[model samples]
Target chain A: MSEVIIPNVTRDDRIGSVFNHLFRIIAESEKLEGKVLWNFQDVHFFHPFFVFPFSLYRYELSNKKNVECKGMNDVVQSYFSTIKFFDFMDLREIGDFNNVLKCYKEKSYTPICRFSLSDKNIERMQSIIKDVILQQIKLPINIESHLSYMLGEFVCNMEEHSQGKYGYIFSQYLKKEKSLYLCLADDGISIYSSYIFKEKHLDKIDEYESSALRLAKAGYSSKDRPEAENRGYGISTNSNLLVKGFGGAFFILSGGAFHREEAENNIFIELPKSIRWNGTIILMKIPLSEAKNVNLYKYMER
Target chain B: MKRNTIKLSTLLGENITSRSSLQILCNILKSNDVIDMSDIVFISRSVADELCYFEESYNIMFVGMSDFTRKMLSLVRKNRNKPRKRQEQDSKFVVCDDIETLLSVVSSI
Candidate 1:
């Protein structure tokens, strides 16, 4: 059995780097056809960042190799269980229609849930935004509007672009940090893969992920090149609002590229050679204080 | 001019973020109808973009947005009508190929 040791993604480790490291393990082990054992011995604190990526990739890994996750301590397992991480192992969904089960408002973390762009899921997510998210933050209407719009744009983009049947999301309000941590991921055609078809984007393409991320940030859409649908506004506007408007952090890792953004800094870089996310993973930290003062127009109206 | 008023908040509480859905709803209204955004606590950018198209309504007037909502909408309206440059500027990023340079550069902004 091939054993892949899961690293502790604690406060000490740079989250983006840790995530990529974990992803590197999965990407490298995909060719191994035998039983794959995931060791969680090093994990002590269970951060939500690990749940989305591992859950998404673990399922895919299971298809090619018999996957077994062990070494989870009580705390790690409990956190994972609460978020329904194990449930996804068998591809089992808690809600048949569209519900990422909720424990209570007090739990402060919404279980990872699957969604689509269907009208029903849109409504469901709206409810989640208000009840699950807004209620927790208890911000005034201004922040409420931007937060709802930001979250909706990300999810809707996934619905419209991911081309995957179900997009997954998990959000938690970290009271200590006064920030909302949200991660949206999908196992679908990645941004880099989709952009290869665009003739305008081709000449600008680099062997690295710089071109794909730049194109995405620059409002280039693989689907709507010059159409009227405002296809590319989601990533650009939302990133601007988070990093520029709210002083928050926005991150996206897809294929071989990872882009990280904040108010004063923006970095787009290629992941280690041969390390690529088959689909995409987006991790955002919405600073609660700055979000309250966020001016949606500043980012959106451009 | 026949006037019909529709409250966006009634459809989806104080926040209305969906653009295509809002456009579809606006499609059903007459050019003279009044759509109330007053009850709306927040209006998303894309939805506001669609709303800007109603400048003449060819069809309707978006009304009733709170001062904050109105301010947000007005910005979208202002930019939507402004003539945009034919050549879209390329997005700039300080891409770091190596760890030292990446560490030296700001990672995200």
Candidate 2:
């Protein structure tokens, strides 16, 4: 078995380099002359930025003959399924980030699995997280349900509204650290467009920071079809779950605006300068101890 | 009294009427006394499908129909005519061109 290791790479633009390294691993592994051929167990110290390339590689490998990958966590499985869905819809060749953005702008519904878990995937993840919480964290049933629901709802919005390209599903179950990290990201339209595009009178309103804050309060949607049954509860529910339930932090960066909802009630503080990205990324960290009693259904109900 | 006006557009010169437009004519049948449906320009397959669904969902009577709309409805009826299981009953369809004629039919019923 052949192996390639990328050493001490600390640049975000080194995505191509990591891909090259993985490609070499795949090529060598295929031609190895041993029964117990090339294995990826020796892979060490993958940069967080390597997630996208790794996901793409896994997807390609899954389609190849005589190649099978297993033991992936729920997050990785969802990512794999999303890529497969996009490839099935012939969207894998959408080439370039700009083209992805353009397709979203056109609302083409081309079945591109933009970088986030869909609602279906989120619900599935919630069930898995809830079971882990119940068994490991030993939390009350209600608490377990609450946390799971909130997490699912929060992550689902990344797919429902982003209209951008690519989504990320990152999960780590660290035995030593006794913690779990789950993050979902998408490069799509932002909360600013959620308000600005539908409201013609808000054209002069340039204060995106304030706008994002107001939207987070409750009962807000920028969709033109206001008569539709959109209760605008996602942001508010996320706030309650993160702050009141878990005493956690909820951060949102969209449309050149940033807001952090810390472990407090109804107190949202704004940060200076937006992250200036075309999408949203949510990173959630929960101690395995605290997550034990997280009931997603109860959280969603509340 | 009945009055009808038809507007022609595009080279095909075929009249086009949407399901919503047909609903408007249905409303006219319900309200007005005179029947005139000569103004209908065209009816596409989509409109016919919607009308079939609408007939199933609502209790509506055909007032008046142009020869074109009538023929289209007949074609759909003939195509869908089949003996199926009891659970697979087909939806009803009605075709009418003039609101006044439809109203007269409904009033007579």
Candidate 3:
């Protein structure tokens, strides 16, 4: 039996450290065999950006290998429970997820949720999420509508491209900073894998995840369909809106590559050594107050 | 020519992203057909570009657009109508099946 230690991580000023720790886990995760023990004793704080991907990972690992998670302090346990992180690991507790996120114990969050392919019911979740954001946080109508646009475009693109059965998501609104943090992780056809099927992309992107990430940033769609079908503008325009327009941070992690972008700052990309992310994970932090900084028409591709 | 009315909110919702939905509508529409875009707060750039694509085909008219929707629609239209970039036709790079093939090509260089 092998053991993996869950670290205490948060999305703070030291975000580079958070990602480095995440990469270390991915490098280690690929090696585990037989029964595995996951120790959460040191995880005093687990931000969704740091923990939601693992929630999906733990769910996937359960199907193939024996995995057990134990030892969490009250703070870690409450954060996990509030986000419904523990529910993902326990199928019996899931109960089809019909009753999840019913009570908004915390006004600022929506629990970790799985948007399954069979149901195709992201609308209900979107409604609840939008309501939570609007009611609790007083955002300008334009910001509210644009945030809705970002969610619709991002998730619709996910549904169209991923081809994976299930994707996990969670969100939170910070009152003081007036920022909204949203994340979605899917063990699906990653950008690297998606390009393999699209012969049109064969020349544009290398098979390497880094190459795929570059094309993705450059407005290349991974759809195998003809260019006339108009399949790939979602990520490009939305990233511009979030990172460039709102002065927010956008992060995408898949395969061995990771990218982070923000306005008036240098773009960050990491080709982590020996790391293999079986799927894709994205996190966006949008400053609601800065929606005025962006001229919507200016960001759209002409 | 007989004009038809197409309500965007009814076609999708207040916030629209799916462009194919409108593509389907355009097939039944004709030149001068009116698309009612009232009550629509947000439409993605892709969807706006699709509207631009439809303009070349059907030449339909979009009416009842709020200031926001109209601005986005006009921007995409103006941008698409700009002078075109000459097509390179894949002369810039080599096409391969996967990453392994790409690696082989790079190693040879």
Candidate 4:
């Protein structure tokens, strides 16, 4: 397999950089004497910041070729169209999980298992993961529920917020450390846009920094009906699930800012600097022992 | 129990009945056997789109399809393949013709 390394560069036109790499790989594959299986594997740290434009490029490329592209199954394909794009964004988190798994495997760690979301294969993927976890780890029922619930929350947010631009989800298990790392990402309207949409007069405000701060606060939403019951619960619920329940570290990066939940009080503290990205990315770490404590109101103040 | 039936005419109207009928069809497919497409005399593209979503979700196999249904499917496929073009024709008759054949084919499936 050929590998292409993208050098660390300034964040100007990140989308263009990704597309340039993708197109070059496609072009080079076409020139090969036989059918060349191309994998755009080396590009790393590509947050949801570039997923939208990259997906659009992929869609247009597929149309230009006029042949059905098979790699992106239903969940992935939904990210390209307006109908289901927002709903499918969290699926991108799988990409981040896959990357971490690759890193751990290289260090001689054995991963429990992995799966992908395809239109035809979603059932199979879920079964495989469930079977592996049940037989190997013997995870408790409550722990399993916790994991599933968290996963659902992440995936649901992607669908609701990303507007079908781009999203992925991934998980990795490290045997030696007995820990799991999961990441979800989306290239869509950032917290900045969410805030701006709710407060139109704030349009002139520098969104990148302020959006990050607001996201760290509880009971805050970019939605118009914030006062309505259950309006702004996802982030706060997620934070509670991570800190009090799982005793896990939660990191959220959006609108060029990053925030981490403190382990003791579960307070969301802003990171020193913004992340230099246009969208949202979340990384979560869970230890096996603490996974059992995941609960609904662990992090909620009331 | 006999399958709950909704007439094609009632399904076509722009009212709550249309939405309810479509939703009923979707719910039935979730638990029951394959739908008898042959009995379906007429269906709008909107209905077809909903059916496609159900078919995809359940992984339902289209076993029997009438020629009209096939033609409608083909037309839908063809239309999606290229840009939409305005063709002078009677929309009502076209739907009626396709519905009969497609329903027959679907029932067989």
Across A4-47, the per-residue lDDT of candidate 2 in tens digits comes to 33232222221122323433444444443432222333333443
- Candidate 3 vs 4: which has more lDDT: 3
Per-residue CA lDDT of model 1 for A136-174, tens digit only, reads: 665554466676777667666665566666677777877
Best model number under DockQ = 1
Model 4, global lDDT: 0.41
**Candidate 1 displacement at residue A110 in angstroms:** 1.6
Docking class for model 1 is acceptable
TM-score of chain B of 1: 0.66
Q: What digit string (tens of lDDT, one per residue) describes model 3 on residues B1-109?
A: 6787888687666766555446556657777777888888777666787777676777778888888788877766765544432222111233434434433432332
Q: After superposition, how far is residue A191 of candidate 2 from its true place, in Å?
A: 1.2
In candidate 1 chain B, what residue range of length 10 has the lowest lDDT sum?
Answer: B82-91
True lDDT of residue A97, candidate 4 = 36
Sort all candidates by TM-score, best to worst.
1, 3, 4, 2
Q: Model 2: per-residue lDDT, tens digit, B14-89? A: 3432223344444433322333234343343324444544444453334356665565455444433232112211
The predicted structure with the larger DockQ, 1 or 4, is: 1
Query: For each model, chain A TM-score?
Result: 0.85, 0.49, 0.85, 0.52
Candidate 4 similarity to native, TM-score = 0.43
Model 3: colliding residue pairs: A207-B99
Residue A156 CA displacement from its true place in model 4, Å: 1.4
Which candidate number has the best lDDT?
Answer: 1
